[model samples]
Target: MGKVTAGLTMSLDGFIAGPNDGPDHPLGEGGMRLFDWYTSGDTDYVVPSGGMTFKISSRAAEMLQEVFSSIGAIVTGRRTFDITNGWGGTHPIGEHVPIFVVTHSVPEGWDYEGTPFTFVTDGVESAVEQARAAAGDKNVAVSAASVIQQCLRAGLLDEVHVDLVPVLLGDGVRMFDHLGREHIELERTRIIEDPDVTHLTFRVVR
Candidate 1:
């Protein structure tokens, strides 16, 4: 069994993506500023999927490496899957890790040989379950605001990691919206500070 975690870079005002986000504007207007920390340092870190690389601080690079290495599978929303164009057939985490997309219906031409994607139309719960099963001892990463919200509401998430950027986006897609009125207590577990971003981790208090 493995813990279900949700992680993403977010603005100080609690936005994950700026307003008017779409395929053409994946991160929304001016949202690219949120990722400035990725290339603001000297240490070179390559994505396991071999899709990209980043120059970050030694501490940030080491933390990212540890986190990336622990991920065995991913569960994300269809909107995110489409936003990144399915990460060009292979997720940035790695090709070996399976990705379960929570969607109402499978997209046409999405199925192909040696694909790492699996469409789950039933619900987020089913998708998370499948991801956990596939992950074995490793962690199941939940991505996208909608999917993470669903997991949080359903009590399926064990941890929340946020790369807190400095700037504040006045209007945009929020990461912690629609969670109902229930108070979800979180135990702060760790904080890794960098000049451009602050990595915060919390354990969901069940």
Candidate 2:
């Protein structure tokens, strides 16, 4: 069995993305600042998917390597899928790692052959189930704000990892919103400090 986890780079103000996020403005206005840490160092780290490379601190590179290697599959929202244009047919984590997109309907002209994406119109739970089945012993990473919120509300997530950036976006897409009025307890598991960002991990106290 694999643990279900949600990870994202968020601002100090608890925003995962700046306001008005869309295809044209993927990270929202000034949201790209959230990822400045990716290039704020001297160490070169190539992504597992071979899609891109990042210049980050040695510690950040180590953390990224550990995290990326542990993920076997991903479950994300349709909005995210569309924003990245399906990661140009191959996700950043690599084609070997399957991607389950929670969408209302399959997009037009999306060929299934040789593609790692799976459009799950049924719902987030079904998507998570399918992703877990594909992931096997590795972890299933749940991305996107809405999808993560759904998983948290449904009690499907086991852990949450946030790369806290030093910024305050006055208005943006909040990561911890719409999770209902109920308090969800979390046990802090790990914290890695860096000049660019702080990596925080917590186990969902179910």
Candidate 3:
């Protein structure tokens, strides 16, 4: 079985997204600052923000590549999937990697020709099971915080990775909200520090 993992780039204040998140503003207001490191050289936002165009450290680059390479399938919430518009109606990750979306309602005339997308309305657990099967020996990663929280609360997540950015959003969609009263123990697995962001990985101790 494939291990279940989740990753999110969050602010120091613990928000995964900023206020007024919408279709036009996917990351939310000022949320793009959290991903500045990953998109340093891109011409789109770099020039306007006046952020320095610096190369990501070798270690960070290697770690990111490894994370992507290890994933065979992805599971994410309906909001996340819809916000990205199914990565513009085709799996942006790749044509081969399968994407399982957890949703209450399936979209009309859903179609992504080159890539495979499975809409699992049953629940997070069902979506995870299908993703794990699709992943085989690789990891099944969830990108959305709601899905991650669901997996964590249900004791289905194996690992949680966070790219901790230095900025604080003050108020927005928090990553660790509404987890109920259950206490989930985590063991530190890995940590890679960079000037812009720190990569932290923790194993959910069951």
Candidate 4:
């Protein structure tokens, strides 16, 4: 059996990105404050939901290794993929992992280490179905704010690992925005109090 999940860093003030966001300001003004947790070195591939920073500690690393061990494919929102690939320039995802992108329209050329990119616009379910098929005997990783929120709303996410950094953006983007007035249960929690940042992991139980 396979499962889907999402993990993101957030602030005490509940902001994933700073204000003044746009295509030009991907992270938005002072948005980098949410990324302090990504200093985890070149090892961990930090995926920020709503652009919050969460440090990767030894415990978090071990947990991530455990969870990501069987990963065979990945899915992300268009904006997230664009920003990440644009930053990577050449190699992205650190490996030749199959990726499914959610977008209304396909771009001219989207390449990351020559890996194939598939665009999905039908819905989150359709995207996950394709990703799971491509994933084969491995776990499919969901790595975008909008995608995760959709999955969570659609009751698709199974587990999530997140690291919480110490910073307050005051405003910007948020990962759990569309969750609406529904109450989401907090299944599990792991707190990492490193000097650099405070990391936390949550396993959401639907």
Give the best candidate by lDDT: 1
lDDT of 3 by residue, 1-206 (tens): 77899999999889999988878878898877887877653223222113323357777767766887789899998888877777765554566788899999888756646547888999999999999999999999999999999998899999999999999888778999889987899999999988778899999999
Measured on C-alpha atoms, candidate 3 has an lDDT of 0.83
Superposing every Cα of model 1 onto the true structure, what RMSD results? Answer: 0.7
Most TM-score-accurate candidate = 1
Clashing pairs in 3: none
Candidate order, TM-score descending = 1, 2, 3, 4
Misplaced by over 4 Å in model 4 are 22-25, 40-56, 85-92, 111-114
Q: Write the per-residue lDDT of candidate 2 for residues 20-53, one digit (tens) a residue.
A: 9988888999999999999998999999978799
**Ranking under lDDT, best-scoring first?**
1, 2, 3, 4
lDDT over C-alpha atoms for residue 64 of model 3: 63
Could you give candidate 1's per-residue lDDT for residues 96-155 as a string of tens digits?
999999999999887898889999999999999999999999999998899999999999
Each model's TM-score, in the order given? 0.98, 0.97, 0.90, 0.79
TM-score-best of 2 and 3? 2
Q: What is the per-residue lDDT of model 4 for residues 59-143, given as tens digits with 9 covering 90 to 100?
A: 6556655665667778888887676653443223344566788889887666434655788889889999999998887777888
Q: What TM-score does structure 4 among the candidates reach?
A: 0.79
